[model samples]
Target: MIYSEKENVKSLIEMSLKVIRMYDWLLDLYVLDFFVDDHWEKLPKTWRDSFRDMDPQHLGEILSNKPPKQLLPLSFLALIKSVDALSIPRQNTYKPAHKIDLKNLDNCKNHPRLKNLFLKHVKLKKRHEISMMADVVVDTAMQTGCNAVIDFGSGLGHLVRVLAYRDDLYAAGIECQRQLTEEARKLDLELEYTAKKHISPEAASKLHRPLHFNITLSCYSQLVKLPLPETMMNYGLIGLHPCGDLGPLLLKHFVESEHVKFICVVGCCYMKLSCEGKQQGYPMSDYVNRLDSKLSFPSREIACHAIEVYCERLMKGNYKDLKIHAYRAALERILVEHDPKLRHAPVRSIKHSDSMTFENYCSLALERIKLPLPTSPSVWSRGYHDLQQWRRVVVVYTLRLALAPLVETVVLLDRMLYVMEKGMSCEIRPVFDPKLSPRNHIIIARR
Candidate 1:
């Protein structure tokens, strides 16, 4: 059932607290420590037996083949069913109560020719979903009476360009990477020249003279140090998909800055967030931070899980190429046995060709980590093909997958609560189709 924004925020915080209370067990279970740690024997007998009894050939036959869904053996199906039962209800976070209409922009009456020009330019360069998101943000900004827009973590200034061209608003982009900022500036110049050539001089003169958008090349961590335009009074903050800490930082800035009147942000890369120190991304609100029961951060892998994508893929029965997890697990087992020091070291990713075999994959991984090649490739190949070993890895992997939704719910809810606690109006809604853009939840707030 759908709940009000205040109710949803309360429920999410309580649910997250419960998960944190069981942090010790959840860490061991969801992090796949049963496979990573050397103490598999210490786990409960029932847990160990579940993995041991799984039929490797049955799993391979079902997951390896492409196409129509295949019925699994009773044992495999039973384990999956039990795991599904443990899943936390994520309906409130995954599906929003209200629908966001992109076509609403067509009704707005401001700069009809300029809007047409901006829409056509962005449509040709960006994906359909992204273009729709931009249209919605510009419409919102205009209706809210915002005189300027500042896009945080603007990658190539796609949104900034559209906002400036569509209306007479002064637009600016804050980008951390120098290379991306330079590329966006070049594209901005090209777009301006092209727009001037296509439209009449009278129409072009109506737009901001010179039609140039400012792009600042400085890390968002130093946002307070950056200078805002003194001439602009009201500003709208927009972020297409601000990754990691930048999302929370943007919300904090919006509430504190007198100039910012509205904000629309889509956050991503939860795993990259820092949970400790002054710049912690999660628990942004003073209410949650001051609670007696402290919250523990999930591992990088667990935090990175995209639960909505998993649900969509599972429903479509598109399970193929899952053997990569088994292959990686086998390599980890080998590393733990031989090189104790490098067992936990991060391995650099290498390109995986479809034709590459398990042995070749392991070799490339070892080489990337600066380790010597295995003395006997045949021995390792046998271990990978061994039915029991393969089944054990897949079963553990399934358990981790089940907890993904709960973890994502906590992260998204934290952002929503942070904005609400500051006495501002805010809501979380699905702005884009999950099938097209998995990170589709947009956190919209206004002061």
Candidate 2:
């Protein structure tokens, strides 16, 4: 359904900005300097005092928006409530879960076409995304009398293959990676061959292979030509996690193109948005621009994390797994102490971080940088005692994590508001489960 919730979306935009603006000091801090800069000591004493020794299990529950198992300050409780209020609510509106069987796609034996090639090659997370995205695109196409869909930044063309399954519609993909484009074509042919055995030769002949464009969206737009078939005079746009500027550019494409009827786009890589340049992704609408609610790079990066999954880990008593934050922070302190210039330097990935000691982590981390290994155990022993600092890290992280959805709310609302300002109908819905795919919401707009 096309959304007429401009007022509601605008109100959410305003509230999210208000809440985020109030916590400016917290969200803007670089996580790499959490210990080196003494970030924990900077937390409000009341918050620091309450969470200093809280059990991991309870903290998890609280972060998950459940009622705290024990009593806490009204201020603390109020902060948590604000996060719940400002953020976007989990949505099942787009996916007809009751009507369809997305509860388990792997176990599903419904689709005889393409055999397991359509679903088995991908993980459960991807299956959920593709299923919901395909449903939305197909539904929108049917709704708007559109017979085609242009997949913006369509990686691997999983959705393209699914759309090609229907003889009634045509599917095309715009991808930059040559390998993915080739692979998608291979998969499409495999799909057709496998599907022909299930249907008559006449039916198979009616079906078309998905068209693949092995060019970057930017490169394609620069050329300014869309040589679409006459049958595809009307089409919709579908993007499953078009990173950074690509998402906004697709919206711009929809607005400018006369043949485009509707759009279903999910975006990721928020930190890559050029907020200040001529090619800006954020502040798309005058509504958000007027609010002056600019997001920091750190906040936008945090917005990409799986908050539901993080909370789930916390609730399951997987405290050791979550210690990566404090561990990195402590490591940051050691690095900065060695060389202040080494602050925020990139380190190679350390495997099995949960089981490794801080000293072990330091050895692995420092070897890449060629920094002298700390000769003093007592000097570096600071990280050992401050292992309790994981709670502090979690506490601060929870506050920032609380603001994450609100951050996302503002970004998505900015896009929606931009579409609305163009005098088009726009809607936002959570299509994938947050635990499985946190960046699940898609912005749907119709002309």
Candidate 3:
């Protein structure tokens, strides 16, 4: 049976606290550094045994060549087992509170107009996911008696356009980027012209005028200073994928704004969260903040986006350039050794073709960081050899991968707890298919 909203939030808080206690060990890569002796002792006996008994040749073969099945090194298997032991069983089991009834909606006359606009928007924006998500938002807004919507960080205004085209609803988009707002405005006009040409003028007139969908250019921080159009007051607030601190900011706005009555937000980019000083995104709830140990930056970074996709690919044995992690780790070690003073310096990511070799990767990384290339080719060969010898690094990396979802859960739950603490009704649901959109979790709240 599905847990009550209160029970769910309480359990989430408990799980988040547990993860915070183990945060340090999960993000420290050096603990598994083969160069450091006796470090394996830090891990459980089962984990150490898995690595000790693992065949280096077999590991190398799996990394270098694709296997027929989903073959994983023993160490990776053991790491998954260890992570699973600490996982919160209820985290992934929650279903959406409301499901989309596409069949019934298809029978409505307005469905054709909605579908046409959605198809046209998809063609212009090349994002099919937004169209699918808009379907749910529109349905929910209608059921809840929302007459207007204000989309935060609306990007290209795809959702805003869809909402405005619906009969009796007014929509507005607030975007931080100037270029995107301008592009969205242009697209709005084009969509308006197309609709006028296809439908009867009276029918098109029934639809809200496309230009009524305001695309404003302003940062989220400046939202209060800007005047909300009369049509936008008392509206539903929605964001497709508000990134990092923006997600929490949306929650804060929802609670403080007397005009907002509904909220639906899908958040991403957890690593970009501001976790320092009074503005930290995590531990927003008073209960989590009062804990003895506070959340750490390394832990927050591990919870960043794309981690779910990585875990899925690893489990499915889709070994397409899995060695990039080892290559990056090796490059980091080289940077540390070359200039000990720069040991803590952040390494900026450098993109390279999939076929790029370790030596090339190191060279590219070094160049990107403005560090001088090694005087001799021997240095490059030495680093590659060291990586090959310490093949267990990949296993350790995979182990760290397992902690991602747990870390993300803490971040998401902290947001939910913040809303629940205010006595607002809220629910976390898998609004989108995980396979289609990795960042599928949506936080819905209303008073």
Best-fitting candidate, scored by lDDT: 2
Better of 1 and 2 by lDDT: 2
Best by TM-score: 2
- lDDT of each candidate versus the true structure: 0.59, 0.78, 0.62
Q: After superposing candidate 2, which stretches have Cα over 4 Å from the reference?
A: 1-5, 96-117, 219-224, 353-355
Q: Using lDDT as the measure, what is the rank order of every candidate, best first? A: 2, 3, 1
- Order of models, best TM-score first: 2, 3, 1
Residue 68: error of model 1 in Å? 17
Model 1 scores worst on lDDT over the 10 consecutive residues at: 209-218
TM-score of each: 0.74, 0.92, 0.79
Candidate 1 lDDT over 319-380, as tens digits, reads 34445555666666677767677665576555545586766877787776788757786756
Which regions of candidate 1 deviate over 4 angstroms? 1-8, 20-34, 38-129, 208-231, 291-300, 311-318, 348-355, 376-382, 385-388
Deviation in Å, model 3, residue 384 alpha carbon:
2.5
> How does model 3 fare in lDDT?
0.62
Model 1 Cα shift for residue 410 (angstroms) = 1.8
